[model samples]
Target chain A: MARSRNHEQWTSPPPFTQEEYVDSRIYSDQDIFEEELEKIFKKSWIPVCHESELPEPYDFRTTTIAKEPIILTRAKDGKVRAFLNVCPHRGNMLERAPSGSFLDGSPSGNPRHITCMFHAWQFDMKGRCVYISRQEEGYQDRLKKSQMGLRELKCEVYFGGFVWVTLNDQIDMTVEEWSAGSLEVLKPSLDEEPLEVFHYHKAIIPCNYKLWHDTNCEFYHDYLHYHNRITGFNDAYFARKNTGFDNGHINVGSFEVQYDNYEGSHSREEISFPHLPPNHWYMIDMFPGVNFNLRGSSLRCDIMTPLGPNEVMIEFRGLGLKNDDAVTRRSRIDHHNSIWGPFGRNLHEDLLAVTGQGSAMNPRAENRQILHGRHENETIHDENGMRHFYEEWGRWMDRMPSNPDKPFVERTTATSATG
Target chain B: MSNADAVRDSIYRSCMYKDDMKWQEWLDLCDEDFQYSITAYSPEIRNDMIYLSGDREEMRGMMKMLPKHNTDHSPLKRHCSVYAVDLEDDGSMATAVSSVVVYQTQLDGINSHVDAGESKVFLVGRYFDKFRISDGVAKFVEREVKLDTRKLDKGSHYPI
Candidate 1:
């Protein structure tokens, strides 16, 4: 925590080991940010949207991943697909709105197509170029519509209500393989219980994307959130487990968070997803930036995409069952909004703390060490998930982090150093 | 004042209480059955979106705990223009539709020279409100803040 004038304190020989600390350079360095963008975000299976978002054929949702425009669509054949949302014909932008449907031009008299508002070039849901204007009169012999098609990305819809996309084609791994055993822990809720996104909102924070993920993995920051302190620090809360999966994914399974412990809040019912016991608090940090969380009566998914080195855009969604009655749905919405919304009891504080951390780390003037080495047999209090994340980050960047400067090194005095 | 005039005046006063950060005064204007929600639709995801929904008790608890929470200090001034006020045929409740434009001024650390002097438009929305008038005084029964803008900056804590 000390930014002493002596860089010696940073490189000091005998503080804590690499297990508990990460180099601050990862947060501040521009070159590292660029490397992370190319190596990690471009290759990871980023969560795009829920399948229900585009339930009808030819429906599409547009978003940006790592600063590149992307479109996820349910094609006419009833299969979902992903493509780069750019017009092939003059390289113009496509789909200005966040989402829309391909109209059957036959209504007015034309073929059905995902029409690009620019230059009127139309593409089918399968990324095929269907029509080009003034084709017969000019350049008919030179230009062929069949020869050009929109660039496609690897898209997969898993058992959970999420759509995952990746940019790299060289990799042969499937989304299920990448997320091995991660959804198994969620099967009782995600697999059997049907769900749909009930609420959607987005906000932009002026900070690196990873800063937001830190708020998810590190449970010690609960002290920063007063409302969480009231209902989250009980004995049952600490007796939890964090399971680390391959490829930087980790799931934290904890006992029920008794929201009823707080004065005005009420107890939860058995209306949680299929087979999920009341008060169950489960969360998955789906490596890179997609997160799925089910707390008591409601579920929320948050996915982030980097806008720049110092800014990130976060899309938040709250989910509930498709057939929930009015009472159950209201309870779900109430529970979700209380903890996950922009004005939630905890999210506002989380955003503030992360943005503040980003601002403090944005300046490279000081050498900072982020201490994540807390261990309580991998309880909710453990920082092992963070350690897992950075190890993957280090593998991608091909260099040891500069803050802690060592990944596997041990500092036996870590307990005292935390003092 | 007449009942309609009282309803309009109460609406203006409610906006004043919110703008001035007078939480207790604002709460006093609400009936026991009052409900407040901030809602918007995202064409990106779903047809109906509920950003924040709470009843009178939940709001009471929130206001009680607000001072202890780490909330944004940036002040917001809501500019409101009442468009239509209509009393129901049965006279049980009255409704008012006011177009609201909220400007957020960065006073603390997050607002630097880039956003120092100008109070930026934080959100543009309409307040669809229901009131119960008794003896020419109006008490808020329900207010649904249907926001047209979905993207928010870092610092919005209060209901818009």
Candidate 2:
């Protein structure tokens, strides 16, 4: 094979048509990234944190959605609620720490209230504004404490106690309806017992958030993981189907992993999750990018906070049964760390690949065609998961994936030059 | 040499061998029952996490398979400061505490022209180590790396 010259490279058409390829601009364009924050991220129900993270009545955790700071707090009545972290007085951020309990009093504020350190304003756990600095002295009649409540977002704890929050109050669907049954595959295992997070880490990678989600959506890149290749390349693995659901979610069917095939690794059957078959693995890739993966002994979840067109912050959590004994918890942690930990065998490899993609596809770099063209009856190696995700993305953005400058046109069939 | 001197020498050698990618030399300094682990505390979940851990035999097997994996081949240089070394009354064991900062020079096969030659601090952590000493020779029995830096960018295939 010979390399193409500049003119030939520019003029040659790919072996696949619009449905099978997407313009790289969607991953690197600044304006398109801003539009995605408005149309896709803010409007969708996102799993921000697990309910176990805020176990106590006054426990709170802070996070961001589409760059807007959000705080989740458990009220005195045993309910978890979400609100904009910004304060109503002077728009100061209410909470700065990642997580803590509001039961303790601060130097300038009372106990059991979310306090704004800026001007000594405070709100109750239920987002009711309870105090303002010198309330009766400063515009007493004009600004009543009752009307100064925090801007509360729609929050629901569901699907195995994950705290789901949506910025759009007009959103038509609940978290269950939005999932479209994509989470049903792991429901038996996850919902059977209360899970507690045992490991947590975050990586601010230089890549579009979707690229990380794409890695979770398909398994063709398993060759990059020598451990996975050795332990999971059997016929049963190849036959696992990639099933796409409505609203762009996809589920990869379960298959037993042969852990004994890899040297120094043993079967995790003895510590398998509740109701899940021994050594089996299941994955649920939620649309616009959150991944829930259960591999027999432990469950791992990846949540993305998109920073820009070329950067994303990914938070990874590993969880196990809340009532595990010391020995069982140790084994569960070992199993979880061996594969998905920050210094694990597989997580770094995926980060390396996506960062490489980010470097090549930086903003203002040349636009190129990225192929999602492989056709394998929607099996493990097929590209159907990404295809389905992009379809939903295009619908929300109202722009074609193949050419962002053009309007989106729905396609009913796969029409590739080679197929 | 004194027991503290021997333990310090062994700790320095471990850093040098790992930075140079001399896996065999590093393993040779480890005792037969050596255990290694990397740990960090996450404020997001208010929990301590064990990121990686293994025994001597497991480390040997993982080192043997490193060549076949897709890794960030950037070279790491560990800067270590041995703060203290305390020897047991019987002189059969020693414990050392050190602070370490690892710097990674970006040299990947996919030289993207943007980050190819830049060097950056990759990790900031403290090493809490235990050693077994016999005949003035110290060997690592346990090394627990507690990292203060949680955002490990692209992370390393090998231990810090």
Query: Which candidate comes out best when scored by TM-score?
Result: 2
lDDT of 2 by residue, B1-160 (tens): 9989999999999999999999889989999999999999888889988999999999888888888789999898999999999999999999999999999888882454656788889999999999999999999999999999999867888888
lDDT of 1 by residue, A1-419 (tens): 75555677555633655555667777767777777789888887888888888888878898777778998888878898999988888777676667777755523224457777666777788998887878778776888888778899999888566888888887678888888677677767887756788878887887878888877877888888776778788888788777788787888886877777777887786568887888788888877887888888888888988776667788888888878998889889878888778667778778877777766776464757777778778778888878777766766677655443444333345432112
Interface Cα RMSD of candidate 2? 1.5
lDDT of each: 0.78, 0.90
Give me the runs in candidate 2 sitting further than 4 Å from their true place. Answer: A1-5, A8-13, A412-419, B109-112
RMSD of 2: 2.1
Colliding residue pairs in candidate 2: none
Report the first chain's TM-score for all candidates: 0.91, 0.97
Chain B TM-score for the candidates in order: 0.92, 0.96
Question: What lDDT score is found at residue B147 in candidate 1?
Answer: 90
Task: Write the residue-wise lDDT of candidate 2 on A1-419 in tens digits.
Answer: 87766956853547886867888889999999999999999999999999989999999999999999999999889999999999998998999999999999987799999999989999999999998888889786898989999999999998888999999999999999999999998888889989999988889988899889989988998988888999999899999988888898999998999999988899999998888999999999998889999997999999999999999999999999999999999889999988889888899899999988888888988788888988898889998888888888888999999899998887766632112
Estimate the TM-score of every prediction: 0.92, 0.97
Residue A47's lDDT in candidate 2? 97
